[model samples]
Target: MHGLIGQLRTTPGGRGEVVAALVEGARDMPGNLVYLVAEDAEDPTSIWVTEVWETEAAHRASLDLPSVRAAIARARPHLTGMGTRVVTRPVASLGA
Candidate 1:
């Protein structure tokens, strides 16, 4: 399985909007196993997203999805910076 973990930095008080956009856009993505969005515990303006997919291609393809495009449009205005992003090979999962 393929996985990605990334952090996004939002404008002040913009985390909630960005999180909502991300969550909404992630629905029904083909080959997506997990798409988790979280608020950073120590940063009011930071959001974390963890995603697991069947393949790297599946993950890449999601970027062209209409919902994802819309979400990017919505979130872009609020984004201030991007933080750590790691590509991973998922070998085990709790429920899998």
Candidate 2:
């Protein structure tokens, strides 16, 4: 399985909106096993996203999806910066 974990820094107090857009965009995506969004405990404007997919190609293809494109555009205004990101090849997982 292919997976990704990333952190995003949003404009002050804007994490909720960004997270909402991301979640909405990911809905019904093919090959998506997991799509989880989390808020940082200490940083109100920081959001973390964890995703698992059946294959790397599916993950790449998601970027071209209309809902994903729209979500990115809608969330752009509130994005301050991208933080750390890491790609992973998952061997096993409980949920995904």
Candidate 3:
């Protein structure tokens, strides 16, 4: 599995827009096993995305998409965006 974990800190008052775009993008990734998105309970402006894809190619494909691009552009203005980390692992280990 190929996964991406992203943590975003939105500018105050930009949370709603960022959340909406993330919701749309999360629903849009194809063949994704998990696209879990959440806002921090303690800090509503913080967003986290846990995404798992079938392959690295699949995840790469998502990066080229218009919707994904749009989301990125929209979020860029609002996010503190420390950084995102990607991980690749065999499917079997998921059960452990």
Candidate 3 has which clashing residue pairs, if any? none
Candidate 2 C-alpha lDDT tens digits along 1-96: 999999999999788899989988988888889899999899998999998999999999999999999999989999999999999987877743
Candidate 2 at 77: error in angstroms? 0.4
Which TM-score value belongs to model 1?
A: 0.97
Please say which candidate is ahead in lDDT: 2 or 3: 2
Q: For residues 1-96, write the lDDT of model 1, one tens digit per residue.
A: 999999999999999999999998998999999998999999999999999999999999999999999999999999998999999998988963
> Would you list the clashing residue pairs of candidate 2?
none
Summed backbone clashes in each candidate are 0, 0, 0
Model 3: number of clashes? 0
Pick the lDDT winner: 1
Worst 10 residues of 3 by lDDT: 87-96
What is the lDDT of every predicted structure here?
0.95, 0.92, 0.77
Strongest candidate by TM-score: 1
Indicate the TM-score of model 3: 0.78
TM-score of each: 0.97, 0.94, 0.78
lDDT per residue, candidate 3, 1-96, as tens digits? 787777778999888888888777656677678877788788877877777889888888888888888888877888876545657474553651
